[model samples]
Target: MARHPVRAKDFAVGEEPATVVVGLIASPGPAAEMAEALVGGLARQMGERLPGARWSVRVVADRLVGGPAPLHELVARTRRRLLDGGWQLAVFLTDLPLQTARRPVVAHASSAHGVAVLSLPALGAVGVERRADEAIVRLVAVLVGGGDAPVDVKPSGDDGGGKHRDALLRRLRELGTVAGDDRGAGLVTGVITGNLRLLIGMLRANRPWRLAVELSRALVAAVAAGVFALVTNDIWLLADNLGWLRQTLVGAGSVLAVVLTLLLGADLWERAPPQRDPEVVRATREQVVLLNAVTVTTLVIGVLALYCALFVLSLVSVLLLVPPGLHAAALDHPTGFSDQVELAWLVSALATLGGALGAGLESDETVREAAYAYQPDRSLTG
Candidate 1:
């Protein structure tokens, strides 16, 4: 008798094809949100793109990488979780920027362990979700296709001549350059474009605006100093005579002063130890420099926000208390909205300087915590 083709449902439960479970372990906040949102889509894509396997995805919101650790250690930890959870593959997504002594790393995959770690900041500020989706897919493909022959191999029951695998590999190359021998871990380092993009991503992940909110004491001091400046004739005279150039210099100087005071007072700067190995020392120095840069940028942004707020308040005070005629008479010149704006600008600068004094009240831990939510507990030598 003619035989019909065998169907999947016709097979016994035990004889059915094995399902490949993929786990997404994400750091708290943005990384976790992205992982949760992408899990469903990723499962569908994995099933469609890598044929002949029943694919499933699970997202766990946890901090897998709190600080810098050896790449192998990170992979091993992830591997343990994968095995314990009965997952075939695992990926850890972190918002913190990852760098090697050579370059910033976008992703690291250990095919031997069936685990991957991706730095979200390396993907840039825009289209992070899309890029992350593509990155996870490529990583999954790498793990499934085998590390040695990532691009050339065809999936089981796939007769399309490895086109899908080649396409995934091509996309991965576009994201970053794959390095390291196939016998162990593989690294994907960003190019120049990727580096610039990574910097932007890091800045966003820092969430500089939070610094403004945390500086409650400083904001109060600034408002007090601004109110004192607004009612003084001397400040009005200074504002009237100080040209735009002088005003700009004063504002910049005030911002610099506040940033310096915070950095020094809070001990936010990282200092490398003298007794560590030479390689560790060098890596620590590099990381310290990068962390300091990010911290300084965050402070500047926060101080500028404070300055803008002071300026608005000063302007309103000027409008309400100092009449246009009085402002003109005090400066011995005709005054208009421009005069009011200049006056507000000068007062804001002076108030920002006063805010610097208040920064002393904030503890080192508070500023550090505010500025770096994902800051490393200890610098990684690698």
Candidate 2:
């Protein structure tokens, strides 16, 4: 059975299959160049596969276009154009936005029977950007289209689950090696941690959210420091109160933080030396504004955090020492209150450490700096 397609008959020959629109929806504001290239690649591949089967290409700007439209609402305008205008098979694309954890369900409802891949949804789940994910997206698209009549995709019947899981594990193993670079894998870690860093910076820059995160971190720090101080000052306090298992958690948490910090910190990361001069590379007004601010904030927070960590470390050391010192002093002068005052000082220091660490965890910006690193200025007077 042959049916003429909407506006497609003008181009498609008789007996051509139903019209398929290769619509490329990109976040227009950020990566116009990249999206354009990917769309072109998709169109070319579909054309080669379908062979004069009437392929039309269109790009939707989701950003300049604005978002927050629910699934049907978001694609309402586009869907109308595609379905009414006669696109039987519609394919969509988008960058996985950091703000939302779950994808919009309405996206599924909007499609009359379309496929969305190379989308922010898929790339996000796979933990990679569009560039790295381009090939994977192509493979997925071919699968959705029931395999290319031009190039048949084998169904191996294996579900490819084993291979997919293996690839995921391999990527995870390389996370320690390529923690920051956009080129490599470790997408799972990158998306989760990198997105959090992005959100923290954004919230910090704005007033109300900034205040909220700051207050929350401060509170967490206070609680952490207070708890640690109590545990340290009275070594057997928790053991006496909660018994061995619960008391052990306090020490375990401390040890875990040390291990995690070392793993995540810039010091442990093996970054390749920058090839370009940061100063020579002229940043756009916007990049300079955002990157420079993030860079400065990171440095300030980092310095403050270092001092705070040292303070906590010193206080902890003092906590370990003071109890014995105070006991001896109290024995020598049983009525003296100076020993008690020193004990109070130790508690304050430990609490301060916890507070500082909380702030540091929130504000650590080293990876962000490396990701968008600038060329160093070597234009000093000779």
Candidate 3:
């Protein structure tokens, strides 16, 4: 018989052994909750993805380094507790409170020596090491390296008891937008408003984890778009004064929404813990569509108002060019005061129209949906 005898599985099959152990290290004090949450999240995540592995949380009370992880302390602890159970690896997650949004998670994997170590920042677990929504998704993907088949992030059309609604309810509570019962109707309104904000964010955001990033990003983008519309409307406004670099940046910002949306779909929203209400899903989509429409309308109106203003300003400028002595009869007056006044009034009217149109476009559709989607389940989220 061909020696099928000493197989790798056979060598370890009968051996009594504790399962692979994972070690978690974090700080103490007020950050204890954050540390515990990280450990809990990691354990849960690993349980779902790596069921074969066993894990434990170790809180290192080394306050010498403040809230950030102490690398040496973590490495020392790993050898003490985790290595006993035939542990395969140890991941030390920490928060870098001094850094910006760039490169949050740091992993140090080492498997050849019968042990692997990954030291990564929890990202936004603390206030300072906060990253964007997309960044969080990307980090997760990196940590949970993809080998298995790609799972679709989009919600299946199957009416699974409004899982989406349940998800939203969870988010609302997290955002403190609603409270009380898990299935309370008082939060229905919050769900609508929260969901609308989510749609705008998802459609215009590059990160899924940003389901909770708030309106700061949107406001910033809106301001950039408004500026771009003005500068692009008049080539000289940007090209002549701001130069090519500034013009390019402005143009890029105006067109980056699609890219943001794509990133959010892949790296952000789908992977994030259940957020946004399911019932509000439709409303969120509608709100996003309306925002696009309103954005266009406002841009057009703004351009028209600007044109009128420029025209009137041109007349005033022409008047400045003419000498007082050159002005004779109203017909021959060099300053063109009569024409300038007429143009200014036209400009004012157009400005008023644009402002009114912009105001009118601000329907509750977007706001309601934004609230609904994000803050859907106030109980779970809270």
List the candidates' TM-scores in order: 0.50, 0.27, 0.24
In model 2, state the lDDT of residue 176: 14
Quality of model 1 by C-alpha lDDT = 0.66
lDDT of 3 by residue, 1-382 (tens): 1111112331246642123334443445434454554554554443333222233434443233444443333333433333332223334334343221223324332111111223233332445223322222222222222111221122323355234323322322222222222343434444445445333332232222222122233333333333333323232222234544554454344233322332232221211122266433333233223333323322333333333444454346435643434333233434345543443333333333333333333333321122122111111112
Tens digit per residue, CA lDDT, model 1, 207-297: 6777767777777787788889999999999998889999999999999988998889877665434534543343333333334555677
lDDT of 2 by residue, 1-382 (tens): 1211223332335543323344555566444455665666665555443332435566655442354432323333443333333333333444532222243221231111233323344333333344323442343233232222212222223455334323222221221122243322443345335434332433232222122123346446745665666546363232224434543454345434433442354232222222253321211111222223433344344433433444465456545654655554434544224443344344444454464466446533322222221111111100
Best candidate, TM-score-wise? 1
Backbone clashes in model 2, listed as residue pairs: 71-106, 94-120, 95-120, 96-120, 277-375, 278-374, 278-375, 278-376, 279-375
Q: What is each predicted model's overall lDDT from 0 to 1? A: 0.66, 0.37, 0.32
Over the full model, what C-alpha lDDT does candidate 2 score relative to the true structure?
0.37
Candidate 1 local Cα displacement, residue 90, angstroms: 17
* Cα shift from native, residue 10, model 1 (Å): 38
